[model samples]
Target: MEIKEHIIQGVRIAELHSDNMLLGSVEEAVDLLGNMYYNQADAMVLYTEHIADAFFDLKTKVAGEILQKFSNYRMKLAIVGDFKQVSSKSLQDFIRESNKGRLIYFAETLEEALAQLVR
Candidate 1:
C-alpha cells in the first residue's frame, strides 16, 4: 500500500494505491479515513486499478463499506479513474445516489473529482 498527498484547487487530497484489497471491511475503511484526516486531507482519491483486478467480485460490498465508513466520519471520498470498466449498473446507481447526497463521488477524471471535493 502507498499513499501520496496532492493539492488541487487549494484542496488537499490523498491518493491511495494498493496492490491488494486494502479496504476489505468497514473497520479498514474507517482507519484509512482516519489516516487521511490526520494527514490534513480534505478528501481521498483511491487508485484501485490494481486491487480491482484481485477483488473484482467484492466491488459493491467494498464500496458500500467505504461509503458507510466515511458517512460515519463525515469525510469525503472520490474514486478516480475509468469505473465503466469495472462498475455494474447497480454500483453505478449507488454511486450516483451517493454523490447526490454528499461526501462521496465516483469520477472518471481526477480533475472533476477534485472540483467536487473543493466545492
Candidate 2:
C-alpha cells in the first residue's frame, strides 16, 4: 500500500494507492484509517484507478467500508472519479447519501473533492 499526502487549499488530503486490495474487509478498512490518522490527514482522496481495473468486484464494498471506517474515526473521505461506470444502483445510492453527510463524499474531480474537504 502507498499513501501520499497533499495539501490543497489548506486541506490535508491523502491519496492512497495499493496493488493489494486495500479494503477486502472491515478490518483492513480500519487499518487504512489508522494509517491515515497516523499521517495526520484531515481527509483522504483514495486513487483507486489502478485497483479499479484490477479488482473490479471489490470496488463498491471497499469504498463503503472505507466510509464506514472514517465515520467511526470521525475522519472525512472523498472519492474522486466518474462513478457512473459502476453498475450497482445500491452503490450509487450509497454514494449519494454518503455525499450528503459531512464526512463522506463522491466527487467527479479532485478539485471538487478538495473543495468539499476544505469546506
Candidate 3:
C-alpha cells in the first residue's frame, strides 16, 4: 500500500494506492485504520477497486462493520468509485445516504472525494 498524503484546509488526508484489496475483511480494515491513525491522518481517500466485492454486498454486512470502525475511531473516509454500475438498490441507497454526511462519502472521482472529505 502506498499512501499519498494531502493537507487540505489544515486537515491531513491519506490517499491509499494499492493494487490489492485494502478492506477485504474486518481485520484488514482495522489494520488500515491503525496505520492511518498512527500517521496522524484525519481522513482517508480510497478507490473502490481496492476494496473487496463483499463490501458492496449489503447482505454480507461488511460495509457496516468496517464503516462503524471508522466512525468509532473518528476518522473520515471517502470511497471513490463508479457507483452507477452497482445494481443493488440497498447499496445505492447506502451510498447516497453516506454521501449526505461528513464522516463517510461515496464519490465518483478522486477530486470529488477530496472535496467531500475536506467539507
Model 1 Cα RMSD, 1 decimal: 3.0
Candidate 3 per-residue lDDT, tens place, 1-119, comes to 89999999999999999888898788998999999989999999999889999999999999999999999998999999899898989998999899898799998988898899988
| Model 1 lDDT per residue over 1-119, tens place | 78777787788888788777666566677778778888888888875563344223544566565567788887788777677775567656666786786698878887787787877
Residue pairs clashing, model 1: none
Worst 10 residues of 2 by lDDT: 50-59
TM-score, candidate 3, is 0.97
C-alpha TM-score for every candidate = 0.75, 0.75, 0.97
Write the number of the candidate with greater lDDT, choosing between 1 and 3: 3
Which candidate ranks first by lDDT, i.e. highest? 3
lDDT of each: 0.72, 0.72, 0.92
**lDDT per residue as tens, model 2, 1-119:** 67777797777888777776565556766877888888988888765563344223444465555456778898887777788787878777777787778998888887788788878
TM-score of 1: 0.75
How far in Å is the alpha carbon of 81 misplaced in model 2? Answer: 2.5
How far residue 110's Cα lies from its native spot in candidate 2, in Å, is: 2.0
Top model number, TM-score: 3
